[model samples]
Target: MLKANLALLFIILPFTWMISGQFLFSNGDKILVIITVIALITTLFKYGFTPFKKNIINNQYIYLLIILSCISVIYNYFHKSDIINIRSVLCVILYFIFIPLNIISTRVITYSTLIGSIGAISFAFWQKNILHLDRAVWQLNAIPYAACCLILMTAAIILCIIYKDKKEILTISILSAVISFYAIILTETRGVLIAVFSIFLCLFVYVFTTKISVKIKITFITILITIGALGIYTTQNRLIHDTVQGFSQYKQGDDLSNTASRLAMWKAALLLIPQQPISGFGDNFEPAIENLYHENKISSQLYNLHLLHFHNQFIDTTVKHGIIGLVLLLLFVFFPFYILKKTEYSKENKFAIFLLTFGIIISGLTDVPLEHKQVFTLYIVFIYLFLKKTHSVK
Candidate 1:
């Protein structure tokens, strides 16, 4: 029981801290990082870390990629004297390396996924009522939150389909899906909505083609019903208002405030890209964006905000780290999907890959979720575990 509890803590700590870091009034990631280190030490001393030795040594390419990315960051650090921002970059490396090294197994991954899903859903609820922070009717950073929930929901759904004796677990997964859908609506992030719809459509097609049990089919419908009901209850008013506003903006051919601002940021980023095209401006891209916005006389509220990132991970990488950085970023995003294709695994394992792919794609479109130390650490652990499990089965 103690070992199980410690293992669970190691799996979920990174994700819990990542979400909390954004919503909590305090610096949640700082506390999470400290806790993670302590947890790592405890688990290592308790479990002896030898279980992961073969997995780590076998998948050396991932290690190499991590090393290369770190080297690029070091190159940038020296070329541009930006020390504070380097913490974000370093956080990515630490999570990528430590998570895979410490916790990558089927049992650990499954436990982590379950716990992480709960933590993410809980944070969504806290953000809505507890935070009470308001902005535009349709503008919210709920995309990352929703995307995270959707990944977990998809995983749960797949597990229910694959596992027979786990009826109670299936019921819990259904409830989780319902709550996740509720949070997704609150986020008002159109990008995430699109991604979720697309993935579900694909899943629907897959399910239709595959030979699934009638019980599983009924369970799927019940899950959808729960999600739909929860979505209505949670966002009935905002949903109507947002829908009308969205349609009106589309009909009028006018960009919504948030969309317009993103366009402006994209343009500003493009302009700066040429200035220092190779290894562009390093981590000083935020200040560069501010200057560009001011020079262009853009009066958007987003322009006034001290933007830390380009709001798009790919563009941000190109602007900060150049082509090499962009390639590394693509590898980190794509390699897992390739591995998923190559490996013969259970439905739950495939679902994990789909979840990771969906999250990373959505995350790339808006805000650098991967840049956050806590979240990236969680991502790394998930990826490592997925690959290791697949390899073992093969």
Candidate 2:
């Protein structure tokens, strides 16, 4: 019992920050490493090596992908070009760290998420209202900031419903949900807006069908639709205008707009995949884009910038590590959902997994999520915590 309490105490800040600290660059990574070390020590002292064996076996797909990724690194090393992808390697390390983490109670997880939502929205407000920034960017891109806010908002809203019997937690979750929604609006990211509306519709239908009075349900849906419509109305300047403008520019033979650039990169990635179907380009992905430019296969507008990745996660993984890598990435993302289905976990656990899987899939359509360390850590750690069979007890 002492060991369990100690583990929870050590993880509270780091786990909370995982949800809120997408704006942090390297500092978040450092804190994660430190807490992971503490988790490792405490878990070992409490349960020895036996506990590690089962979770590791349960998460075989994740470990398999990590192994293959490391092999790719070694393969690139011998080839003497595109020798390493530090981001991928760092993600692998994060996965390893999460395995030893002791399972935190559901209540702790709920409160931590509440704290995280407040922190995330506070930062967004500071950036937009106080600093007067065009987009709420601080040490991270606005796109990712919006994505993280979406996660916080979704989690908080769901927690509010799950813990509605508890007045204090319910109140905190509601505040987090509201602030988190505002934070997403402040980001001016179109991709996350699509995700937000999608999730909102899904959650609304979920609540509407629940065992509640018809009038209450009607009132709930009315309030939710009002909020959703208002959010969309507020962001029309960026969401609707930019999308229409980008499509119009593309049709007019101009590929300079943000959406057009993403389209071009996706095209280039598809074309490149067939050329290196098995072994990918490793870290020379950008140079391959340049080659396509010189050959007139892609636009010079895309080639001019030092673009770090293809905006889409699947295409980016396919380009970087080929078909095999893409397969592994899919397995890694969907494995938790699969586990939830095959097991009789609690409803809260299942819902957490569903929200995460849905959010990642939706957001990945517009961004490379794992390339960002904070986002990567957030996904892996939560997946482990919520899905761990033995450690979920309060």
Candidate 3:
């Protein structure tokens, strides 16, 4: 049983994530649900619910999010609003699916991340260089594809620094990071560029807090600088030109460029959030945007863009679920840091937690990642696995 679960985690889960999108999330949920049910029944037949109870007690935030989501589901049901919000938040329940398994290894998780990163970048190159797609994507929307690659890239780098003593692993991990970053640039999801900088800042803070040698710290810094330089050099001309043109077009009121559309969406969301600051629109994001359009609060161009969720996660949450949901989302993301301070996990485990959590949060600023079922599952599953390790260490 242990070996089977390890292989599932170390092989199937990571690879599927890199190459597939909706199928990974929807079918992945079904597979995990089956595993959780079987695990629960077998455990109940022997040890009863004590193990599950203990896990639930330890991870209160997950349940809180679940409870909040249930309320949203009910509210949306009655109001005839879209209940898609439930799909993403309810993924937190799958966190429990791993609690009964003892083979959850940070080393396995790190190596699996490397394998997935390699696969994602390779798949992306095939799409761009061979198939000749406009943007390199890991078989999904460019936004989430870039987001996942960012997580994988940063994870590879952090793991490389953590296991720097292992020469072969370090070399592979560095290669994984480089190729994964190159994939990100190819995707051209400009919003995730902020997430790239946010991750480096996190790496710097982690280096200073640890007792590692100065040489390793410097090497990490050098790697980050090289990656940043590579990104800038590869995309400098288009990035600068498109951004300026987009801004100029927006100011002149003849804009439908990428930057302008996002700004318009943000502006519309801001205007609407104040009206429903308590419970929000409750999955009625499209209708609310329509209302803004009818009232002349937003441009017809933006309204015609047919945005389902505001590009910004914070604003999207506030608009859809109101301020309360926004707070819960923040708590869910930053709660790991609280655990990190309270626990004595090793440096690698700690950085893993930090990198993954911040990767989602920062990228979310310019994209509503939590709106996607897959991104939600990915975040909760990995965070719990890492946190479980800390719980044992504690």
Candidate 4:
């Protein structure tokens, strides 16, 4: 029962941000994280710490990543004003990497998908129908809100097709997928669409290339293609021409253009990276990049738009944490793909994690999905859950 509760809370981590956005004074992630920590402690006592100790050598890359991140944070601690924030980040690194993936089961993964789907779908419905908003963003900025929508949507699909849960849960899973699709459309985030499509493309390729049943491959491809077509039709602005036009305007140096603004920030980050290419300037990175924008005499529109980080994860990590930081973060993100390829494992785990990690990387190309509370939290949890070695744990 204790384990079950822990699993439920793990799935609801994404919804915490949803709640925080809705309430006037509430810090949803903080409250949920505290509850999760308490639950984790209770399970640790009941099950013993052995769950986290298994297969340490197999996950040497993950530990190496944790060490590098800690070292970088410590380097910045003496000079950065946000000393507490730096420490908090180090703690998070430890917490995520050390989670006992032994506790994860098929049931837990499906439950997380169902619950997150329900939570995000409800919020999206409320924002669109009752609020009468053209773009349904609830309490989150459009980017994070849209990121949550797609993540939950993908989770719902994985719950159904990958886990192959009971018929009752299968019904719920299908419903969740439908609702997630609707929410993704209403949110109108281009990155969300890209992430979702990338998921389908990745899955389709997997199903086709693997020795899976022909029926499964055909059925899955048909469903995904149909859904993708419908989604593209429903969201008119999420069109190829629209994106091309944005790029064209950006190329023309349109300061107000979204693509142009993102480019400006990326350029600014690249310019400053050479100055501090080792240990970064650290927390509250706005002033450093902003200063460069002034020196370069570029338009200040991105700063005005409250664009905080470089939208690209690789670029942003390199800027704030330097080349060493960038290497660690990349290994942390991509090591699963490397390790899983060389070893035998459950196809479900491989596909689930691949779908997730791939979507994140693709989305990161155009936006800062890592900065969003929902995206990073989900990534950390799923990474540990799917990658852990199979060992019996009580």
CA RMSD, predictions in order: 5.3, 3.8, 4.2, 4.6
* Cα-based lDDT for every prediction: 0.57, 0.71, 0.68, 0.64
**Candidate 4 Cα misplacement greater than 4 A, ranges:** 1-26, 48-65, 79-103, 134-138, 165-170, 284-296, 389-394
The model with the greater TM-score, 2 or 3, is 2
TM-score, prediction 2: 0.84
Candidate 4, poorest ten consecutive residues by summed lDDT: 17-26
lDDT of 4 by residue, 1-394 (tens): 9867766465334334322222111254565456556555654665556645663556654565466556656766665622122332333444443455534455555555566666666676777778877663356566666676666666667667654536755777777777767777777777778788778788778778888688877887898889888888877676566677778877887757656677777777777789889866666677765675677656666657665677787888777777867776687678887878887878877776777787788778878776655455555555655665442322
Which scores better on lDDT, 1 or 3? Answer: 3
Predicted structure 3, TM vs. truth = 0.81
lDDT (tens digit, per residue) of candidate 3 on 1-394: 9956554444334323422343224365555445445544554555466656666665755665666677667767665553344544443464353344443354555566666676667767777788887763345577876777776687677657666777766777788788778888877777777677677777777777778889977877787778787787877765677888888989988538887887888888899888899878876667777788888888888988777777898998888778877876787688778887887778687778878877887888789876776666566666766665532210
Pairwise lDDT winner, candidates 2 and 4 = 2
Measured by TM-score, the strongest candidate is: 2
Candidate order by decreasing lDDT: 2, 3, 4, 1
Model 3 misplacement above 4 A: 1-57, 61-65, 79-99, 136-139, 166-172, 204-211, 341-351, 389-394
The candidate that wins on lDDT is: 2
Model 3 collision count = 0
Full-model lDDT, candidate 2: 0.71
